[model samples]
Target: DPMVMAMLVDKMQEACQHLDRLQVRISDTRSSVLVTGDLNAGKSTFVNAILNREVVPDDQQPCTALFCEVKSVDQNDGVEEVHAIRDPEAYRRDDPTTFERLSLAHLRTVVEDNEPGYEMLKIYCRDAHGKSDSLLHNGALDISLIDSPGLNIDSMKTMALFAQQEEIDVIVFVVNAENHFTLSGREFLRTAGKEKAYLFIVVNRFDQIRRKDRCKRDVLDQIRDISPRTYAEAEHLVHFVSARKTLLNGLARSPSPMARGAMLEPASEADLADFKHLERCLRQFILEKRARSKLAPAHVYLSHLLSDLRVLLAYNAQRSARALQRLDGQRSQNEARALQLAKLRETVLDRLDDTIADTAQRVADDAERHLNRFLDHLHHIPYDVTYHGMMYLWRYADDLYRAITMRMNGLAAHIQTEAIRLSSAASSVSTVVAPPSSVSSSATTLAHRDTLGAGNVPALPELLDRAALARMARGLLPGLGALAVGLVGYARSLVAPMGAGAAASHALVTAAKRPNPLARGAFGTLAFAGTLMLFYVVADFRRPLEQQLCRAVGTHLRRTGWVRRHADATGRRAARALRQGLWRFQSDFARIQAEEAVLATQWSRERDACQQRGQRITAMTTRVAEITEQLEAINLDT
Candidate 1:
């Protein structure tokens, strides 16, 4: 995005460099008249018509590939020659190395060859007409007629530079009378008209037009659209004449040694008169007002540059401000998200710990209290065991104890797992966020938003991988209990769409059908005790003895701290898992915040750059407007 800003603003920066150089050029003694128009528009013929000689080559083919600046021989120490400059930027009129010398006769070959090697050809020649009639013989000002290649042949930038060249005092736009204005011609006139407001428009080849009146009217209409001032001064500024005829007439009037084509059609009286009139007006505009005309290009360049500068400055300022706004909004969002994460770490994490601890403690207390009460009711408890013998009594008794313990443990663990699972489900969160566009350290800032985005999925805690404690109570529960557990798991899979508890009843009914092997083996002990009770009629000792054994076992398990240990282990696992989730959320949140910090730095640099550019733009705008006013205020003291 910064590149976008640079791409748009680089032109303005380059334009700024020209202002100082242009200011210096405004005070120069020499004046220049640029001759330009569409391809095959007879530009070279027009120049030849003005000078009344074939100083430049002209033909039906597209020639004049480069600029041919025609000036009086006085600048070349009264010598007529060609200075073919390969590089215009390094050109020095006095320095012989700057340009290659060629005979004046070689001008035609150079023009026709479409020389890509040279930037321009400087042609110095003498005027054959009397001093009074000669436009180039002015003693007060030196004017050079720079004939340029046709429009669309040169780049727009090069054309603009060519148009605003330091010494350009006036512009003469030539258009074919029969062809009228091409798109390139219209654009050239429009641009030239801005620089000097006044343009000398020569509608060439007038002798060729059949509908002379209509052609004039159409040309005026287009001129009015592009250059209102030229149209308003149509009588004085516009001319219709055949340049070839004028050239021929000049040959007839005062033939020069340089003139070629001795046999030529004489110019019509009307054509000669019109061209002479045009010559009179142009000579006056160029020489008489040379001092004032020199400032006009600067005035126009500044006027247009300032107008465009304002637009560019406003656009960059607005875009930079919007980018800053987005940065601020992004910063705020990052802060809010960070705070949310902090809450999870500080407040929510603590709440999770308390919830897990309370649930575990409650399960532990319930296990201890209810278990002791179950053991206390051992005398009243029912059993399906039939007395077989004393041999398997201990085996059956141990099984009965294990079954009760495992049942209680399974219930407690189920509650804990469900609680922790719900907690994890409740606390998880996933949110996606995009980072703001950033500015480069350089002056270029992205005028648009960035596509690189940020997102986070907070790691949710799951209960740590704790093995089932009830599964370890193997001896007490029948194989059917294991089967029941598996059945419950399978049922959960089938009825999962309904909910977790949907298939619980199916597991319980399946468990009820399977009788423990221990129950059948324990019946012998019960039968032996019953026979004693019948024979001696003493108080039955089975219930009291089992009660005594239950008390002893409960007391020993309590001493070992089995209940509290399970509860604490479960709580520790939940806490550890919850802590891990919190850490993960913090890690992700920190990364996002770090990116925001980088963007913040970029925004800082961007804002400063934009402000500086905006300030410079403002200063330049004011300065250019003032300079334009100053130039306009300058009066011709001549």
Candidate 2:
């Protein structure tokens, strides 16, 4: 089953070449079988037992100090072989002076960086060194073994990495029989079981406790209470063994019979039987894992991968928003304005084109004759008519620039005047109302602006208030007033549907009883007072919306005249300066070249004399600074 899954992972890794290969390093190859536990909880020993090997290095030290991988290797002619993955130690070395290349090589290398004391698990084992030529024979099942660093204090990195790779095939948790259950151990089990891996609770060195009366059984029961998942999985499958003894027995079995006397554990028959049973159970569990792997292919994990990807997308989006917030929000407003201007230009083409054509023709006609007369006179001169022609060009350019600027300023003023006229007409029905205090400064600026003796200025008529403008708009569009009335009545009905009718009936009855024409008119207005209240409510809500519309219209008006003029002025200035400078430089070409030759000769002579000092550039700078300081002090004294 592992074979099938491994093949699938291989194909996926091949297809994802466009993405950086580093993404594949963690999840590629095969499902990692993370063998983790306490220092002497038989993690390394358990790995060796499952692989049927006596090669994993083991010691009695608190930290065993190496992360090893026993993977299938390849030989010529389709022979299957096991090879130990080797690379530089990915840990803090005894010699701490050099740390430049402390970790293992990059992800592409055989062994990845798994620095000791860091809560990461790293072991990459492949059967072959190259691509799989034959999926049947030469193809070797690849399995990553994650031997985690000690877990006295939970490392956030370790927790995150484990959470990321929650598709673990099997969790081999080794518990030492002698030690009591610890908080760290319980925490590890709780997290490990939740990952949905097949849990295996192994009691290492069970031979020491198996002989005591109910001692081994008591410890096993405690483990069951602590790890329900592990206990359930082990109901039909649990292993207890002295790994060191097993390793020695398997390796030294064919050795001289006397050499076997020094086995790591007691030489009791029961100890031998325990080790043998433990070995069989461990083998069966691995087989079960392999079977599961075959039953569910690698695509089964794609759903989890996609889920993690969505979370990552959300994280990145938030990160970008925060980054932009730090960069200054004013730029965002400028960008939005630019986009709006672009969209408006597409719809306002005919108006913009006509304006541009009119401005260009008028400006050119006004300046052309003056420029031609000057050029004609210059051509008659004998000493380089080209120079005179250039001067004529510069003057003509300046005249054109001035005419264009005037046209643009005139256009902008005309647009603003028309806008004010429309605003005036809308507000012509009632007396003027003062604008809000917040707009007082703008109002003052408008009042003080000098208007020429023309009919463009708006008269300060009585009907200049918001209410007057609304009434005028209603006269222009009948349904607009009706819509306002309906919306208000709808909202009122929601609040007091029955009481609203009673109030209306009372007002109508009072209006019907009125006799005098003026009094009847007053009563009729009073009868519709509720409707006026609703109209005011809608009017107040529409103020902000009106301001936005006015602003947008004003921006379009400003761009129509201001932007064209600005572009024209800029282009004219650049053209004029270049033409004039080119003319002047050519007219005095000989004289300027003669002067530059003299200056160059003098500069070279001084430079040669200074070069004899042979001082370093840095020293010369220091000396100059020192001299400047002394000179400053002398000036101060004087």
Worst 10 residues of 2 by lDDT: 430-439
Q: Show where candidate 1 strays beyond 4 Å.
A: 2-6, 13-25, 36-45, 52-67, 84-91, 97-120, 128-134, 147-169, 182-198, 207-211, 225-229, 242-273, 288-297, 330-398, 402-552, 555-638
Q: Which stretches of candidate 2 lie over 4 Å from their true place?
A: 1-31, 48-53, 75-168, 210-227, 256-261, 264-281, 288-638
| lDDT by residue (tens digit), candidate 1, 1-638 | 89987976787676777676667767666777888877888889889888877788887777888889998898889999999998888999988899999888888888778455777899999876666667676666677888888876768534754555444677888888888888877766666666666778888889888989999889899889988877887887898888877786667645565345653556778988998889887876676665546665666677687677667667766776776677677768766866765665565445655644554454345444544555456446665444333455445445545443444444444535443553354335323332221211121111111210001111111100122122222222443344445445444433312224636656554545544445433443444444444433223323433454455445544676544554454444444544455445546656766876786687678767766766776676677678668756766435
Error of 2 at 265 (Å): 5.7
lDDT of 2 by residue, 1-638 (tens): 69976986776575455133323533454444556676567766656545434334444644433334333433222333222222234433233332222222232122223342322223223322134321112233445555543354246534643553344555566777777456677777766544333456667776667465465577567667766645665643456666656655555654633236656454466656776665455444444345433222222233233344445445544654554454335445445644544453343332433433443333333233322332233223222112123335334333333332333344434433332332233222111111211211121112212321112222223213465456535532334444555556444433422335777877655644543455434444543654565456544433322332233323433444433443343323323333333233333443444555565465455444433322333344455456545533432111
Candidate 2, residue 478: the lDDT equals 36
Best by lDDT: 1
lDDT of 2: 0.43
All candidates: TM-score: 0.61, 0.34
RMSD of 2: 38.5
- Taken over the whole model, the C-alpha lDDT of each candidate is 0.64, 0.43
